[model samples]
Target: MTPRTPLAAAHAAPLDLGGRTALVTGAAGGIGRACALRLAAAGAKVRAVDRDREGLEALAGQTDGVEPYVLDLTDLDAAEAAAAGADVLVNNAGIQLVRPIEEFPPDVFHTVLTVMLEAPFRLIRGALPHMYEQGWGRIVNVSSVHGLRASAYKSAYVAAKHGLEGLSKTAALEGAPHGVTSNCVNPAYVRTPLVEKQIADQAATHGIPEERVVSEVLLRDSALKRLIEPAEVAEAVAYLCTAQASFMTGTSLSLDGGWTAH
Candidate 1:
């Protein structure tokens, strides 16, 4: 069995999220859903936002302290409204399109950048004042390993994620004096519906078998040779939102199975 990191032990303390309002974007799927459930389990009043109404409702049904909202991150105004009064904001909405820069469509590139980078910036900007006034806040942005390292056929994703890291760092510095913390959880290829779809898309794009896509393409970059779990990502988010982590901000906690170790 693999050993847990010291940070994991530090994050194991119990927290009462009761009475605290948290807004999670893309909460209908994968890592976002996991984070929402974890927050609700810790007694947070979770507002789960997603573009899929049915999925959001389904997730809300399974957990207490959770409310569903169907809103697209592309709608900056709607996102701002949904984020009002939230003590903790998890910017988790993202999309992937695997293609070379030469073949990438201009519109698709813009959309990906908008969702991953622009939306989070706007959401943070909207939430900052409320947090500042309250004198307490937490912002957890779900970035990716792609943010730290580059890969072929993912130019736009790479660019947006890299930008997100820089933004998070800046936000953390500004929020430090206000008792607000901003950080990011950067995970490698996680075993989620989105990743499964990416595997298939990659297979089709490269004329390779699906199995090869997992082993050769995804795992090829990781020293640990395994896909990161969604729960692990959620656990990290939970840690960042705790009181003990108040002094910890503007950092990236990598859940990449040692993807960047080399």
Candidate 2:
């Protein structure tokens, strides 16, 4: 075989996150939980925040360096408070409500937006001063493929994700000179509890079988013909936190399995 590329050789070495403190929102389940676990395994002290107290505690119990915090992201003050003392912030909390725009409840719309967009912005704003003082920081916003494109029946989620992309870009610009970077990981459908629920709901609504929903409703939109894994997204987040990624900011790394290729 040909010799490995220089970049590939560098990537083969393990990332060192020792002594770093990271705050991961929505760390109770799915992608968030995976990210928290991966960070802890890489030697980071992680503050795992989520609305599910038991779930957060369970995750903390399993991970050596994880500290669980039960908090709602819709409350900006609480989110900001949870973010204090973190060198890295992973804004991964979000909700998805599937309904037509006309049928979508106003309260649900506001709640999703508040959690996905507003809370990430507030957390970044609150965390930046401390990061600036340290002259180093990383903000990883877990956006979605929906952020880059649109789909039917996901009005609120898509809108909130789109707005989050913009906010991350703005934050990246402001943090550039201070050795801080802000970037987003936009992934397509991942096989998570959230997606499982979506599959069930879609099955019920569309009068299709649960098995068919994954292939027909979810992956049908993607060119890769596969759903992404939570670990895949978590790996991308971890890569962005490294020293090599210092020059990267205000950009999105899409893990969409070619969903947006169309």
Candidate 3:
């Protein structure tokens, strides 16, 4: 007999976010955009934060409950303050550069750490007081496969992601008693504009032609050949906020096509 999967079984309760507010960083596009739309569809009033104002406007036009908050995450105090009064917080903003550690620009490296790691910390800090007061909150960190495994030519990204993993776990432990759950959703090579840009950067960094980057470099470790969809990653993020997932905190849910299983 085939075992019943999550999709195979009928859901006893549908996701309902009425009276909830969700804050999604990087909500201008990719998985973050999908998450913002999904949560809005579930009746959450979504505060969609992004550095790109144009992208945010376009995204806001397509969704009913998503509103844009335009700010660069490098402003740590602003980032933290922006997260106050949120019931669900999806920390999904990040940037990447493909270069050897010696060749990596110091400024770029610092920016990556600030955006990916420190900003999330500050945002969580800003969010916790309200969550602890209310006795409920969700923190979903959009980590990457890079967080769990190292790759050559991406020193800043790998370092920042690894640090994020530690922070997510620490937050989980501290927030547990207060009904705040912190977890990471780690996906590999999702189809997004960021990845489209990385294809060229990886090609140049790995010294391979652009045409062969997907096959030779990006999917080399992945058991699945194709890239994950943004919506699929959003579904994972959505699941984490459901009542069924209340006990599932401090763990990483990997969408890496079995890359970690190896």
Best by lDDT: 3
Candidate 1 local lDDT, 30-85, one digit each (tens): 99999999999999999998999999989988988889998888898887777888
Sort the predicted structures by lDDT, highest score first: 3, 1, 2
- How many clashes in each structure? 0, 0, 0
lDDT of 3: 0.94
Ranking by TM-score: 3, 1, 2
lDDT of 2 by residue, 79-133 (tens): 8877877899999988887888888999999999999999998898889988999
Question: Which scores greater on TM-score, model 2 or model 3?
Answer: 3
| Ranking 1 against 3 by TM-score, winner | 3
Between candidates 1 and 2, name the one with more favorable lDDT.
Answer: 1
Candidate 1's TM-score reads 0.94
Between the candidate structures 1 and 3, which one is better when assessed by lDDT? Answer: 3
lDDT of 3 by residue, 234-262 (tens): 99999999878888899999999989989
